[model samples]
Target: MDLDALVGRARSLAGGGATRTVLGLAGPPGAGKSTLAQTLTAALGDAAAYVPLDGFHLSNAQLDRLGLRSRKGSEPSFDVRGYEALLRRLVGEPAREAYVPDFDRSLDEPVAARHLVPAGARLLVTEGNYLACDLPGWREARGLMAEVWYVDAAADLRDARLMRRHTGFGRDEAAARAWIDGNDRPNAELVERSRDRCDLVVTSLAG
Candidate 1:
């Protein structure tokens, strides 16, 4: 994958009219969507901003109350309506500065206003596991994007990355494997089904 070419494409997206253009990155867990989105935003500097869907993760308390702790990363575990509203605000109010939330892996919680989309930003780069999902709330979010890119990676590579991520965040190897099999794998499969709905497929950043 040519990083320069990808940057060039992002630059083109940032060169549009006064209305903010949202570029969404959709992929399964550990597919490098966040990495690519951050890279593009960094390269574009003030012209681009990033918003991640992981920010809409329901709190652990909410998950436990709803009996969804074991399925924490699943579609139902997210506040999809909140995510949709954020996207709508970002697209509808380009001239206004907006605060963006983010999920903190260290705290294993969602933090409020960890990022800001400045009024000068012309392009907004958002990435997540379910951006291309065909579900009701997700479909509304996708409709606001100027384009969505499906990030892809090899199964083995994704599994390896997920294992590292889980263990790094306090899960034991056995627990990590079980969670991946029970939760992440199913979510990945569901996201894969929506790949055809994306405007582009991105494998360049998979590595």
Candidate 2:
């Protein structure tokens, strides 16, 4: 996948006048965004932290309260207001370190006060489904990033991966298939429209 290329580019951004700006990676679910983010953060060392958009997802109770559980991955299901505030804070470059939550998929919960970015960090690699979007306040997201990347993969392959993920999470095979075909695909289509907003198109080879 030539992660070194991305690692080197991000490392250089910290050296120059760049204020450890955010790099947004936008892609559909099961698109390997977390994999890429984790890999890049490790490759970049202390200069960067992987800030996830998934942490902004509303809790299950919140979704149930809003009647948005069936549309969980949709844009309307997240705490966009909170996410915007966090982005504002990061862009403000506060002198003190701030704590951000990380989404723990195995537990299907957001781990509180887990990931922290030091004020002097040189770069932040944020990955999520909505960063490159143009819906409502979502458009404001692009303005907060120094750069963006979009990942594209074969649809069949994506579905295969997603179905396996759902089944691994204990869903029955029929339910897993339905999720991949219905909700996931619709969200993927919507997310793909934002690819035009990216600075780079990353087409990864399977490892």
Model 1: per-residue Cα lDDT over 185-205, one tens digit each: 999999999999998888837
> Judged by TM-score, which candidate is best?
1
1-207 in candidate 2: lDDT tens per residue? 367887786676553444557888888887878788888888887778878888888888888999988887788887777887787787676455888887777877667778998766667888888888888777787788888888667787777788888999889999988877778888998999999988887764463
lDDT of 1 at 10: 78
Predictions in order: lDDT: 0.91, 0.79
RMSD to native, candidate 1: 1.3
Clashing pairs in 2: 20-122, 20-123
Candidate 2 off by > 4 Å: 15-18
What TM-score should be assigned to candidate 2?
A: 0.92
lDDT of 2: 0.79
